[model samples]
Target: MTNKKIAVVISSIFIFIMVISCSTSNDNPSETPVIPAVLNTVGLIRNDAGALNDGYVLFAPIGSNTTYLIDKCGKQVKTWASSYKPGQSCYLLSDGSLLRPGNTNNTTFNAGGKGGIIEKIDWNGNVTWSYTISDALQCQHHDVKALPNGNILVIAWESKTNTEAIAQGRNPNLVPTTVWSEQIIEIKPTGTSGGTIVWEWHLWDHLVQDFDASKANFNTVASSSKLININYNASATNQDWIHLNSIDYNASLDQILVSSHSFNEVWIIDHSTTTAQAKSHAGGNSGNGGDLLYRWGNSLAYNTGTTTQLFGQHNAYWIESGFPFENQIMIFNNGNGRTGGNYSTIEIIKPPVSGYNYTQTLPYLPATTSWNYNYGNPNSLYAQNISGAQQLSNGNVLFCNGPAGIFTEINSSGTTVWQYINPVSTSGVLKQGVTAAQNSVFRSTFYPKTYSGFTGHTLISGSTIEDVNLISTSCK
Candidate 1:
């Protein structure tokens, strides 16, 4: 053969081999995508407004196994390493321990926010206590609250069969083979990995379905929001009926506030009730047992009216005492499914609780919000899901735009005093607008400068602020 012909043949062979190798690599399901470290932050320190409360923010990226504690200047002061990725939430306790919900290999329900394991890790990243509360029937998910009595409050799904749901007036077509309703269980740790289910409240226990009058719990839900409408979310076959995302306890009021994403409402239930009383309609401080003593945000959830109060809200909790708002409620209104498109708002409202039931005549509280913060720009402040709002001791509000990975602190007058864009990106290739979708954080919480969690630890900032690439993003 001629030398030129031989050289051409060799080149063809090499190109063929390269194509085959590339194709094989692309077909491998085990190949992990290289996550990029993209820092997008203005880190603008605007203490001039006096809204800047010197504190540390803690959060874990949705799929990342490591949780971070960063200072106001956007520096990683501390971190906790975990073997399993945090399913959704992580909280730093006052005694230097971290209470975190994590995902397990178990695939019982395979639903969103299915966190099977709750672990208590110390300051040095050692697992001090761990509990597994998931099984084929039910599993913990989303948010967990640390109670005052050392017991932990967890949110789980109570699985119901199609027949069971139909019996409760659920439309058969909407009821898949299995349906999941929200439940709250207060667990008292008896051992390292096991706990006693000290107190429990199930959404299934308090339901009213006008769909089938023949079924049990059938009622014409008039003014009472206590009975959940089983057919309210029957558009699709998805069984996550009431996707309860957050749970907050008011120790003074002895009530538990839960935020339901699917229902677009926040319900206040009496925490002072016994387990048996909670399952019944009468027997608590408010004489409403496990039933919702007060509900707001979405009035249509009850038969009251069709006024859209809160459009898929989150992090509904009571403000601490001594603050200006004091006993008012603070919430992150994830303004999804709104008339004007996607926009978010931070709102504070005063609930009129004469006793167990809400005394307000209006469908929802506050003919107008007592105070609120919206960027004025429709798309300025929006997170479709997994965001939160916290009221700081200094009367400032810390808002977490979870999907956007942006955390901001704003003054009472709605002035942004500080801002930080999370630098971590799930996709190695950081596209400007889609970074939020790729890399999301469930929530970010602020701890005061004097938080006891930092007592014994030597804190140092291991993070550097990098200029963020601004993205023109729109919300659905």
Candidate 2:
């Protein structure tokens, strides 16, 4: 689908997609989509990329529980809606399947949160394999990456001996009320007994300071004998409060790169290529520390925070297998509310040499730092300052003005070549003259070098796609 055609389809959906009426608010079903999946597009399109020749876009639309798969031109292709609230790490496999982490909370999860499930979805949206951590302690905030040998690597939060710690009287000093262990595990599909764990890592054995105590959000840490930390506890574990949101393994470097969103840094686990996970097994004891190595995002000799490392972003890691910069780290800098520097941006940076390296020679899509926002009053559903950015093969950028549900395509020089808007609303909330309409985007993501599909058929392909082919036999 061409950008123009995609725009028309989005407009049509907006024109017919009914808005909920307030008169029926009381009678409205309790299950209105909390993550409504309406979508749109933005930015200049691309064509052939050096290494990233073709790929799809993956995103969590508002309302829907599934992870959507759209074609190169913004055409709805497939979906993996396995959980109510899908986690941040979802990788599209080479076979067109998807790998994602999910969880279920004992108490009520937020309106859109639910059970946890590590899943492998086939192209037909079928669950080829699934593992649900027992109901006692739920695993949230996880990341997954597929290895060359078909094994999957994961970074997750595991229920620690905290309850056991309190029972044993060995709780660390100044620990938050909520405590849990952050972990990394590798799963290999064994034709018969599901996937087997090949390697694993944890956050406990490596901490030397009161890191979790600094994270002070989310009750993942604890000071009481309570089985778990208060849901209000700021940091969960890792005194640094390392909220590991995304993980990527570089086979070339035999290294594991983790995006610790909350802690404001990335962690690298370096293992020599000569011994790339040679003798590793998952689900091992946390006391052993030889099987792993570590480096801080900005403190190491090679990482100098050159491009201003991300602050609270989601899914920052290597591109897909066939992507142009397959090994480079591309981040969806969600710009989740606060950035000491620029308001929001999507950054694609080359991996650092060792640690403590820095550079600004990367491509950046900057959000409109200042944009007025007034719902209804002539500007209802008005654009806000929040924005999204993705890197294309040819160095152009795909930018999403998240606040107003607006998306635009830009060239390498920062030009809007294409655009889109999301119009998702609640079931019974009418918007006559309000100041914050219910239709917009929480976030967006594009496939490496490929035009990640958008809602309906609003595509943001590269400038190479001069015109979108909406009526092509491609959809048939």
Candidate 3:
């Protein structure tokens, strides 16, 4: 054979081998597309093979009046409009309605998470029910929970004058001019603009303090584990004393979980008690009435331990019945003043429970978390305030870094599988490539495609909410 012919045959053989290799690589499902490391790109950032692909994310930005539902591809599937900005949190109910709180900008309860109204907007954008709890001395704020029986539980701040605070055994020096306490109200929607408070629990009634012996509720602070110590937060001059940021209900247990940002603890109270029984310390299923059945995170709040486990935590709730760590409590442990440095962690703990009451322990139970997740370098997940975590059905965890408006989903092994950044900001929807600023979201929720809420609704995917799109199409 001629030397030229031999050389041409060798070249052809090499080209054919290269083409086959490329085709095989393309067919492999494990291969992930090369996502550009864009500095400030919004929408979907990462969507790997392990991420749950058949679910949508729901979020309401704190600065905007619009709540959104986006698919795994970061495309808008649905949206609900509100007249006022989010008080802080929103949720998509199973009945194709948006349950959200509207920030009425109440001057009386002029503090963070100041929401005065709760609205139930149907799938077609009509306000079917509206209720307001903001008044001179009390205003609903932060989070709300929709119960299985159609009633809504709201967190509100009730104010007390310094004279009233002093009369209640509060330290005169520690009391602000107006001391703000917390309460939970159960509202049954009576009509389009009316709600009847069927049941309520007042924190003011379950207080104990060692500051004043002459006062009626005075007692040894540490021993009164079931009661709140009015003087625990010595440095708190602000009227917003017990800033309860989140609330959750466990139908099976008939209990309520509330996260107190000020005391840095999650407290569970028996909801089986009537309004009359709740005012006293006895006569509930747990025989503890409205008193705390279980409280964890900060042992020092009740003066049981020297150190604390939670720091400015948010979104403390029980894992649903069928999830991986079912019935366990999960918290977004926002490490605001963590010992080493500021960082964040998602922790799940098995509370020591005996029927309706927690097994009485010095500092609660489960000395440490049953499971926890953080970046190898923990600071990567830090969100100083307003964040949340949810346990999905497939054993994966979805969480939001609220202040930065970032969402991440990690598998049981703590490997990040999916991520997205909020495109909506205070001004409006931001352009794709712009740095995400002022786009803080209170929280984000993951709903499976089979969610009952989407049953009859048309969830056609539209373009990204942001003005321009750069990454989602290519990356996905």
How does each model score on TM-score? 0.84, 0.57, 0.92
Model 1, residue 417: what's the lDDT?
A: 68
Q: State candidate 1's TM-score.
A: 0.84
**Span of 10 residues, lowest total lDDT, candidate 2:** 367-376
Model 1 segments more than 4 A misplaced: 1-53, 355-357, 360-364, 375-379, 427-437, 463-476
Write the residue-wise lDDT of candidate 1 on 306-402 in tens digits.
7876888888889889886988899999989866778888888888877556774747565677888883654377788888988887788888888
* Number of colliding residue pairs in each model: 2, 73, 0
Question: Which residue segments of model 3 deviate by more than 4 Å?
Answer: 1-34, 472-476
The ten-residue window of minimal lDDT in model 1 covers: 467-476
At residue 408, what lDDT does model 3 achieve?
Answer: 92
Q: Show pairs that collide, candidate 1.
A: 36-428, 40-468
Model 2, residue 409: C-alpha shift (Å) = 3.8
For each candidate in the order shown, give its overall lDDT on alpha carbons: 0.77, 0.45, 0.88
Task: Give the TM-score (vs. native) of candidate 2.
Answer: 0.57
Evaluation by TM-score, superior candidate among 1 and 2: 1
